[model samples]
Target: MKVILLERIGKHGHIGDEVSVKDGFARNFLLPTGRALRATEANRKRFERDKDDIEKRNQERREAAAGIASGLNGKTVVIIRQAGETGQLYGSVSSRDVADALIAEGFSVSRSQVDLANPIKNVGVHAVPLHLHAEVAVSINVNVARSEDEAARQAAGEDLTAINYDDEANEAFAAEQQAATADLDTSEE
Candidate 1:
């Protein structure tokens, strides 16, 4: 269907411009939303007067988006998670987590802007892309670290299996060590 756009659409056309679009889209969305109207000789003439204003607004929006893109470039975000011995995260990191991390780092980003295929299930550094605008995208670094529990076990000479069984063994060893120390103290006394 031929329609006269009443509003500027993203990277497509400006208000008062005649464009061809699918009939269903024009009827269900554009026409109902007052974004466009059926193209007629009367509407076409009316659009000519408003075309300059629409172009100006579109230019301003593009410039503003470009400025935001510069600030978002090359930013890094870290996600700390509990990981097992095989480097698999105990809980996956979702796009929401990345968005929150960006916000924490003083970046205003939406979850929908994050271009993650799925939840991250492994621990490492990753480059995550954020699609801010249609032409404006930025790559941010994500450093996934092991949680404190995992780190502590690693520092204590333990892996997942070792730590699982070490709980009971550690208690027994502690008791024996304490008893030996007590005997030494008694001898000294």
Candidate 2:
């Protein structure tokens, strides 16, 4: 289907350009959302009449999206979830969780706007992208950990997985036993 785009679509076409797209795309998204118009003669005439106003609106929307993008970019949101000793979360972090966290931080974002393809299933920092506009996107860090201390360590670039608590406990026990043996020797002397 050939349609006139009302705004710039990334790598697709610019505003006021007539481009060919899939029928399903036009029917399901573009036409229904009013982001595009059918390329019929009458609709083309109508588009010519409203072209200027549409361009102005598109520009305003782009500017607004840019402002929001600036605020969202490079920001991190920490999410604490219970995980086992292996750093695998018992429950995963979904897009809704990220959206809620963003809202908590005073950003008005929807779950659909978060471009996470799947739920996060591990304890680590992830870069999640927010689609502020069709042409504008920004990424923020999402730190997922079992506890606040682990989250803090992750933010500080620490590898929590590399720290073996069992090994540390064994070393402490050995040191205590050796100290006891030394005290026993001193008493015997």
Candidate 3:
């Protein structure tokens, strides 16, 4: 369907710009939300009449989004979750969880704004993208850990995810050390 956008809706189109979008999207979202109108002659004329006002509003919104992005970009959010010794979380951290964490830190964010391709299921630091506007997106650090101490270590640049302790490796290293010590003692005697 062809429509004239009243506002910026992601990558679809800018305010007062005529663009084609999915029929379902036009019927269900754009038309109902007053963000767009069908590209008929009358609606086009109406859009042209209100074009300046619509563009002004869109510019204001974009500027606000850019300001928010400037403060949020390069910031890290710590998330504590339960996990086994291997650092695999018992439950996953979804975008909603990240948004809530951000809100707790006094930032205005919504779950839909978090651009997580998939939920985080492991304990470590991850770079998550946040789309504040069509042209403004920022990557924020998400530190997932089992405890406060672990979270601190992760934030301090420690990678515990790759450290897997094996019982056999520990036993072999201990036996080798004992043998070397015994050999030294026997030679001294």
Candidate 4:
């Protein structure tokens, strides 16, 4: 389907530009979201008539997004969650969690704006992208860990997931000797 975009849609077209897109995309997303209009003669005339107003609104939104992006970019948020010994999270961190963390930090962000490709299932720092506007994008660090101390350590580049073989072996040996001592006492009694 051919449509006239009302604003800049990444990879599609800029405002007032006629472009071809999937019919489902046009009808379901673009039309419903008011981001575009069907390419018809009357719609073309309407677009030309109201093009300036649409462009002005788009510019205002872009500017606002840019202002927010300047302050939001490269910021870090810490999220504490239960994890296994190997640094795997008991529950994965979703987009909503990241949005909430950002909100706690006094940033006005939504889950839709957070472009997380997949839920984070490990404890570490992750760079998450935020699509603030059609033209404005920025990234912030998400520090996921089991505790605040772990988060700090992760931020400082410590690998909490590494297993210490010497400690484990020493612990096992101590446990075996304690068990043997208990058994000898029981036999004597």
TM-score of each: 0.55, 0.83, 0.87, 0.86
Backbone clashes for every candidate come to 0, 0, 0, 0
Compared with the true structure, model 4 gives a TM-score of: 0.86
lDDT of each: 0.76, 0.90, 0.91, 0.94
For model 4, residues 1-189, the per-residue Cα lDDT tens digits are 999999888899899999999999999999999999999999999999998899899999999889989999999899999999998999899999999998888888899999999999998899999999999999999999999999999999998887779898999999999999999999999
Compose the digit string of candidate 3's lDDT tens values, residues 76-161. 99999998778889999999999999999888889989999999999999999998876689999999998899999999999888
Displacement of the residue 153 alpha carbon in candidate 1, Å: 17
Candidate order, lDDT descending: 4, 3, 2, 1
lDDT of 2 at 49: 97
TM-score of 3: 0.87
In angstroms, how far off is 125's CA in candidate 1? 1.3
Instruction: Name the regions of candidate 1 deviating beyond 4 angstroms.
Output: 1-49, 147-189
lDDT of 3 at 68: 88
Q: Quote the positional error of residue 10 for candidate 2 in Å.
A: 3.0
Model 2 steric clash pairs: none
The parts of candidate 4 lying over 4 Å away from their true place are: 166-189
lDDT of 1 by residue, 14-129 (tens): 66668899899999988897778789888777668777876676577567767766877776566778778778888998999999988887777889889999888886666788
CA deviation > 4 Å runs, candidate 3: 166-175, 180-189
lDDT of 2: 0.90
